[model samples]
Structure formats: structure tokens, C-alpha cells
Target chain A: MATLEIRDLHVSVDAENGPREILKGVDLTVKQGETHAIMGPNGSGKSTLAYSLAGHPKYTVTGGSVLLDGEDVLEMSVDERAKAGVFLAMQYPVEVPGVSVSNFLRTAATAVRGEAPKLRLWVKEVKEAMAALQMDPAFAERNVNEGFSGGEKKRHEILQLELLKPKIAILDETDSGLDVDALRIVSEGINRVRSTGEVGTLLVTHYTRILRYIQPDYVHVFAGGRIVESGGAELADKLENEGYEAYVKGGASE
Target chain B: MAEQNTTGSTTAGSIEVGTAGAGAQLAGPGTGRTTVHQPIDARVAVKPSFDVNDFPVPTGREEDWRFTPLHRLGGLHDGTAAAGERGEDKVGFTLPDGVTAETVGRDDARLGKAGTPVDRVAAQAFSGFEQALVVTVPKDAVLTEPVRIDVRGEGGVRFAHVVIDVKPFAEAVVVLNHEGTGTRAANVELLVGDGAKLTFVSVQDWDRDAVHAAQHSALVGRDASYKSVVVTFGGDLVRLHPRVSYAGPGGEAELFGLYFADAGQHLEHRLVIDHDTPHCRSNVAYKGALQGQDAHAVWVGDVLIRAAAVGTDTYELNRNLVLTDGARVDSIPNLEIETGEIVGAGHASATGRFDDEQLFYLQARGIPADEARRLVVRGFFAELLQQIGVAEVQDQLMEKIDAELEAAV
Candidate 1:
């Protein structure tokens, strides 16, 4: 089992004036087999936290530590973090032209697995995973996310999550653009990985609909660059009905 | 920065420039249009003259010679670089069934039937060559395999000429492979008979210090089709000029090129297609990647549609990917349309660095920066590699591309 710990994390991004702090003194702990739901309104630094833990170069870790099983993730490069079993399913997955989906996935798997997988077995694995997510096998030959629809992009993220089999995955708004059916399918994919009981998941979303399919062990209400409230699953139901009005007002600048 | 990926579409006049507009200038040439120092004058087209003195030496200021370093021509231009000193041309041919390969003297009637020398280098090649080789396919015959011509330079300065002729209704593919280069200047001619189809492939895989200059011309007959595939990978300096003209209506021509210019290598490809007849079509696509300091690539595509040409459709595209610093590309697309009653004409040229977002995306997937860099560059060239129909050629090109990328680090 693996554990990811973020201690007093402070992240900043370069703006017109200077480095503007986005994550201020945020602390979080995620253990393998545990689901942590970080729910927040727009511009509350929830995505920032996801990117920071994933070692995005744009998000500078000023005064914090991102540890994956006691190894300093901040000092590691982006790919290093991924090899260390930390995966980030970006809210906006990048489009890479000229790179076929099969090539990209195999390359990534080779890096993570330390050797190239057998071609026949690998092709079978991809076809099965894509079929599970309702993706056509043709997606393997197309360029990576080149002309995929939003729902296709979401499903592709889940496809990677299933294939990569990381120790922990941070899904940033995986349910944002998915329709009801796609959401259910993507949620099923997530639940399949969750049921494996060897991976931790941090689902960052604005709605509680996806939580119904993939239940979180703990829910953290994020506001003002920090988690202001935490509870066992019940907190999500409270936010679904009461909304973030009380938390936003409570954490507003005085 | 490379040209932003754009779907092919028919546009009105020629000369289309593409821009990434993503603000990621990876230090490529700023001028996105074709880079020809001057327009090719009307006098560039003429009958082949087998006299060295018929063509004057270039001052490197002419439109055709502007991008070429004249001092590096290995003496094929100014009469200073004599023949049979630096390299000797060793020619061999492997012909398929029902094809003929012949070595004829300069007076052979079949010589120079496809094209004439337009510049001093071509004229010098025509006059100075000790012997010329001609390959022909019989009428109403179709070949299953391609005819292979291996031109290997043993040593010394060599002047050479070659001709490929396909009779009426005959279809054939010809591959001209150059290796073990020296200082060499040569001229190649293609004659496609009525209702014939021909695919001519010229590969220049020269030595690191070799210098080569060649002019290629094709004459398309009525209802004939011509396809030219030019692949250049290794050379200190290599310049190839490919041109085409029509003899009858309903003819078609397609020109495709693939090049990889490494450190201190200069690869220049100049093409001209003259549509003097009606109902002719032409399409040109050339892709190149340059790496290392002082690695440069130049592409000049010129298409002319005469008033007599009524139903003409033509489009030219040149794309360059600059992989490392100190590498530059000059792309110039020129179209001179004398008639407005044509079907369509267009050209596109783009040169840029690798997309930063592409690299980041790959790296985020746990691919190391070096490996990711190699993958991105390979991806940039993958599309063109698929166009090479020969399995062996494609595999060799892939290995060469990988080796070049490995040295980039």
C-alpha cells in the first residue's frame, strides 16, 4: 500500500506582477484504498492542488512537501512523479498530434513497467479496456486526443487510469463534460479500479452526482485555498442541498 | 514550431501561408512563406543543350542559386571542379522482366528526350558525362516490381546523366539509389508515354563529406501519370531540382519528397511544374526535419499554368520541423498562373519548432524528456513515412531518423 501526504503546501503561479499564491497552507493525507473527495467552487484552488501533487511545472511549490510513500515528489520531475505511482487525469487532457493513442499508451506503460509489453497481449488489453469504456478500437490509431469529443476525452482518461494502474490517481473534473450515460460508464470504470482496493483516488468535482457511483470514504469542503470542512460522506449530501454558501461566506476576506 | 495541422481544401489562387499563432516560437525562420531570393525568370525553361558553355556559371545571386552555397558545389558549376578527380560514378541496374537498360553515347537519340539542361550544372552534366544510361519499359506492359538503379561513387569527380522512358499504356516504378558519394553532378530525365503511369524514386544517402547536385525533369504525354518520390538523408550538401512539363492533355503528376538535414548538412529541393496543356493535374507534398547547428533545408516549389491550359488543378505543400537550435528552413512556394479559367491552384509552407504542449503532454505520461523529444520528432515525420510504399525503404528511413535523433542529444 502507498500513501500520499501534502504538508503545509503553498503553491504559486506566475502572473503579470509576480508569483501569486494559490494554495495557502493546505494539508491533506491520502492512503491507498481510500477515496478522498475534494469538492470546491470555481477558483478555490482544488485543481491547483491536483496539479501541484502531480508536479506541474507551472505550479511552483513554494513552502510545502509532496511525499509519495516518504519520497519527496516536489524534487522529482513530472514523469518521475508518474513513475512513483502518482497519476493526474487532467481536467483538460492535452492534444498531441502525430502521436497515436497506441504508441503513447505503450510508451507510458514501458516507462512505468520498465519494459516494453508484448505486442499481441498489449493490443488485446487496449481493445478490451477501450471496449469497456465504449470507445471504438479505431481510437488506437488516431492521434492522441486530436479530434476526440469531450466525452471521448473523459473516457480516454479513464482508459489510461485502467491501463496504467497507478497507486493513486487525481481525477480533476472527470464528470464535467460527460453526459448521463457517459458519466455512468466513466463512473463504472472508476469503480472498477476502486474495487481493486490497491489504489487511492482523489475525485475533484463540482457536483455530487458522480459520488453516487464512486463513493468517497471522506469528503473535504475546499474554500479559500484550504479545506474548511471535512466529514464522512454525509458532508457531500449537506453540500449537495445546502451548497457552498456557508463555507464561502465563512472563508471570505474579512 | 511546425505548420499547424490543417485539412486539405481547395482555395482560389496559389500562395497560402500557415501560422501556429500559439506564441510558441521554437526559433525557426520567421518568414513563413516560401523563401526564394528572386523569382525564376521566364528564361529558365528551354530545350536540353549538351554544351557546357551553353549555361553560364551562377553568381549565387540568381533565384535558383540563392539558397545554394556555390563554393560547396564541388566544382560542378564554374568549370573549376574538373571531372574524374574527387570521385568516379559506378552505375549498376537491376531490371524487372521485359525492361531494358542501356549505356549509350551522347549522340543516342533517346538521350535528353525527357528534359534539357536549364542551368550550368545540368548543362555541364550533359556535356561532360562520358556515357549515359537509359532504361525503358515496353508499350502495353505493366511491371510488378520496381527497377533498381544503384549509383555508387567509388572516388573522383564524376558527371553523369540518366533517362527513364515508359512507352504508351505501360506502368512501371523506377528507384535510383545514390550511396558512397563524392563530388558528383548529374541529370535525370523521365518520359511518360500516352496513357502510361510511372513512379520514379531518387534516394540520396551520401557520405558525410559528399557533395551532389542533380536536375530531374519529366515529360508527361496524353493521359499519362507521373509520380516522383525524392528522399534525401545524408550529405554535406545536396541540391536536387525536379521539374515537369506536359506534352498532351489529361495528364497527371504527383511529387513527394522526404528529407532529414543533420548538423552541417545542406539539403535543398527545387521543383517546377509547367502546365502548358489543358486538363492536367499536379500535387506536391514535401516534409523535412532539421537538427543540429548549421543544419539547413530549403524547398522551392514553382508551378506555372499557361493560357492554353484550361482545366488545371494543382496544389503544393512544404512543411519543415526544426528539432534543435541552430537549424533553419527556407520555404518558398511560387505559382505563375497565366489563365484564370483553371480549376484550382494553391500552396502552403510552414516551419516551426516542436510544440511545447506536445512535449509536456508526453512527459506527463512518464516519458523522459529525451525520449519524449525523440517521440515528438518521430511523430512529426511519421505521416510522410507512411507514404513510402516500399517496406524496406520505410524501415531504413525509420532507422535513419532514429539515429539522427539519437545524435541530437
Candidate 2:
């Protein structure tokens, strides 16, 4: 089982004005097969936590100690962190022209699995995964994210999640822009991966609607660059009945 | 007799496979532009001269020779260079029964009838050639095999002339492969007769020390179709000029070029397509990649549509991928339309380093940065490689490109 420990994490971004701190002092811990929901209003540092954890170059780890099973994650490069079993299903998947989806997936599989997947078997596996995600088989031949719709991008991210099989997956707004049918298909893909019991799911989103599809074990109310309150699934229900107002008022959080 | 050269042993697929639309995404001429850059200069005066003395040696100041290094020309422009001790040029042909090759004197009526020497070196070639090789395809004859001519140059300076004449209603493909070059200047003419189709491939894979300059001209007959593929690799300095003019209406021309330049190599191609006839069509696309310090690739495309050429359609695009820090590329595409009545006319030119986001997206998936880089380059050339109709040539080009990537990327 893998364990990720983020202690007092502080992050900043190189904005046009200067280095602006986004994550002041945040702490969270996630273990294998557990679902952690980080919910917050806009500009509350929720996506910042996701990107910083995944080692995005734009986000700087000013002061933090992130350990993945006692190994230092902060010291690793973005790709090294991925090799160390960290996956980030980005909110905006970058478009790579001339690189077909099938080729990219196969290359990533070869790099991560340490060898090329048997062509016959890999084709079947990818076809099945794409079917589960409701992605058209023709999509495999198109360039990655080139001219793709918003919902298609999200579905592709989930497709990678099902194939890469990382120890920890930080899904940044995977539910955004997805219609109800697409959301159901994407949620099913995440649930299938979660059913494997080898991945730690950190679902970062603004709404509790996705939490209903993929039930979260723990809910953390994130605000002011910190996880101010944490509770069981009841906290998400509370946030749903009310809103971030009770927590943002400064009493329910501390 | 077709004397085969030892350097011609490399199979058509062994050296380079290019033609890909990897640069299509980067082909835009940038935002909100109304005025075109430059017009095709018909008055530049590269007309073929019968006498070598009629053309003066260029000092690199002429419009056509501005990009060329006159010193690297090995005196082919002046008449100081001499032929090597190597006896003759080689030919590796798969000519069928319907095709014929004849070594004729310069006085032959067909010689210089299709094209004229545009520059001093071309005129020098026209004047100094001992004999011209004229290959002909019979009327209504569709050859199944490509007529292959391999010219192996020995480091000395040699002037030559060649012609491939396709008879009316005939179809053929001709490949002229140049290798083991010293200093060589030649003029090539293709006469595509009425209702005929011809595909011409000229591959210049000279030695690292060789210098080569050549002029290629084609005359398209009524309702005739012509296609040319120019692939350049190797050589210290190589410059090629390709010119096209239509003799009658309903003619079509397609020109595709691919080149890769390494350190200290200077490769330049200047193309002119004169739409002198009405209802003619032309398309030009050239892509190149440059690596190593001081490696340069230059491409200039000029298309002229005269007032008499109504209902003409033309488009040209050139793209360059600068793989390393020191490499450079200059691409200029010009179109001149004398008549307003035309189907479409436009051109695009782009030169840029590899896309960083493409690299990042690939690396994010665990493919190493270096491998990711190689894939990008391969994709950049993949579209052009697919355009090569011959499979063996494609394989050969793929292997050569792979070998280059192994050492560099």
C-alpha cells in the first residue's frame, strides 16, 4: 500500500506582478484506496494543491515536505514523480499535434511498464478501455487533444488514468465541462480503477455532484490556502446543504 | 549502354523518406495580414543563354545568387574548373521495351528545345557539354517500371545536359539519383507532351565534400500532368533551380521537395512556376529540417500568372524545423497575378524550433525527453515521406533519417 504525506505545504506562482503565494500552509494525508475530496470556491487554492502535488513547473513549492512511502517527492522532476507512481489528470490536457493518441498511449505504457506491450494484447486492452470510457475507436488515430471538445478532453484524461495505473491520481476538475452522460462514463472509469484497490484517489472539484457518483471517504473544506475543516462524508453533505459561506466565515474552519 | 555506378548500389528506400504535414499546423502566415510580402520578379533575367559568355559570373549580389556562396561553387560559374580523371557518369536503368536512350550531339534539334540555361553555370553546362543524353517514352506507352539514371560524379568539375521526353498520351516515372559528387553543374529538361503524365524524382545524395548546382525546367503540354520530387541530402554546398511553364491550357504541375541540412552544409532551392496558359493548376510544398551549428536551408518559391492565364489555381508552402540552437532557415514564397480571373492563389512560409508543449506532453507520459524529441522530428517529416510513391525509397529514407537521429537527437 502507498501513503502520501503532505505537511504544511506552501506554494507560489510566478505571476506577472511577482511571485504570488497561493498555498500558505496546507496539510493532508491520503492512503491507498481512500477517496479524499478537496472542495472549495474559486481561487481558494484547490487546483493549486492538485498541480503542486503533481509537480507542475508553474507552481513553486516554497516550503513543504511531501513524502510518498518515505521517499521525497519534492526533489523529483515532473516525469520522475510520474515514474514514482504519481499521476495528474490535468483540468486542461495539452494538445500535442502530429502525435496520435494510440501512439502516445503505447509509448507511455512502454515507458512505465518497462517494456512494449504485446501488440495484439495492447490493442485489445486499449480498445476495451476506450469502450469503457465511451470514447470512439477512431479517437485513437487523432492527434492528442488537438481540436477536441471540452468533454472529450476530460474523457481522455480518465482514459489515461485507467491505463497508467498509478499509485496516486490527482484528478483536477475531471467533472468540469462534462455533460451528464460523459460524467457517468468518466465516473465509471474512475470507479473501475478505484475498485482495483491499488490507487489513492484525490478528487479535486468545486461541486459535491461528482462526490455522489464516486463516493468520497473523507471530505476536506479547503480555503485560505489551507484545509480548514475535515470530516467524514457528512462534511460534503453539509457543504451541499449550505455552501462555502459557513466555512469561509472563519468559525466552522478553525 | 547503361553503365551502372557503384555508388548507385543504395536502394531507392535506403537513404531518405520525407513528405509529411507535420508542419501544417505551423503553416499560417500569422494574424490579420492584407498585403503579400513580395511579388515574383519575372525581370530577374535567368533566361537560358546559348553562349556561356552571354552570362556573367555572379558576385552573390544578384537576386537569384544572393543566398548562394559564390566561392563554394568550385568555379562552375566561370570555366576554371576541370573534369576529373574519372571517365564517365553512371546510369542504373530499369528501362522497358517502349523506352529508348540516345546519346546525341548538342546540334540535335531536341537539345535545349524544352528549357534554356538560366544561369552562367547552366549556360556553361549547355556550352561545354560533350554530349547530351535524351531518354524518350513512346506515344501512348505506359511504362510499368521507373527509368532510373544514376550519375556518380568524381570530385572534378563536369558540365552535362539531360532530357526526358514523354510522347503524347504516354505516362512514365523517371528517377535521377546523384551520388559521389565533386563539382558538377547540369541542366535537366522534361518535355511532357499533350495528354501525358510524368513523375520525375531527382535525389541529390552527394558526398560530404561535394559541390553541386543544377537547373531543372519542365514544359507541360496541353492537358498534360507533371509531378516532381526533389530530395536533397549530403554535400557541402548544393543549389538547385526548378522552373516550370505550361505550353497549353488544362495542364497541371505539382512540386514537392524535402531536405535535411547538417553542420556546415548549405542547401538552397529556388523554384519558379510560370502560369503562362489559361486553366492551369500548380501546387508547391517544401519542408526541411536543420541541425548543428551554421547549418542553413533556404527555399524561395515564385509563381507568375500572366494576364492570358485566366482560371489559374496555385498555392505554395514552405516549412522548416530548426532542431538545434545554431541552425537557421530562410523561406520566401512569392506569387504574382497579372489577371484578376483565377481560382485561388496563396503561399505560406514558417520556420520555428520544435514545439516545447509537444515535448512536454510526450515527456509527461514517461517517454524520455530525447526519445520524445526524435518522435517529433519523425512526425515533422512523416507527411512528406508518405508522399513518396516508391516503398523501397521510403524505407531507405527512413533508415537514413533514423541513423541521423541516433547520432544527433
The best candidate by TM-score is 1
Give the DockQ (C-alpha) for candidate 2.
Answer: 0.40
Fnat of model 2, as a fraction: 0.43
lDDT for B317 in candidate 1 is 88
Angstrom error at residue B273, model 1: 2.5
Give TM-scores for every candidate, taking all chains together and pairing residue i with residue i.
0.87, 0.84
Write one digit per residue (lDDT tens) for candidate 2, span B274-374.
77689999988888889999998989887777777789888877878898888878777766666777887767777788887677666666777898898
| Candidate whose lDDT is highest | 1
Give the poorly placed runs of model 2, Cα more than 4 Å off.
Answer: A15-18, A39-59, A147-151, A206-212, A219-254, B1-40, B43-46, B82-88, B96-101, B139-146, B168-171, B389-392
RMSD of 1: 7.6
Cα lDDT, model 1, residue B257: 92
Worst 10 residues of 1 chain B by lDDT: B20-29
Which DockQ-derived CAPRI band holds candidate 2?
acceptable
- The sequence of per-residue lDDT tens digits that candidate 2 reaches over residues A1-254 is 79999999999999899998889898999999999999998788999998788776788899978999999999987777777888889888887765679988998888877789999999999999999888899999887898999989998988988888999989999999888888888899999999999999999999988987999999998988899889999999999989999666753332
Off by over 4 Å in 1: A207-209, A221-225, A231-254, B1-50, B83-86
lDDT, candidate 1, A73-182, per-residue tens: 88998888888898889888888766789999999999988789899999899999999898988889988888889998989889999998999999999999888999
- Tell how far residue B83 is off in model 2, in angstroms: 7.3
- lDDT score at residue B204, model 1, on the 0-100 scale: 91
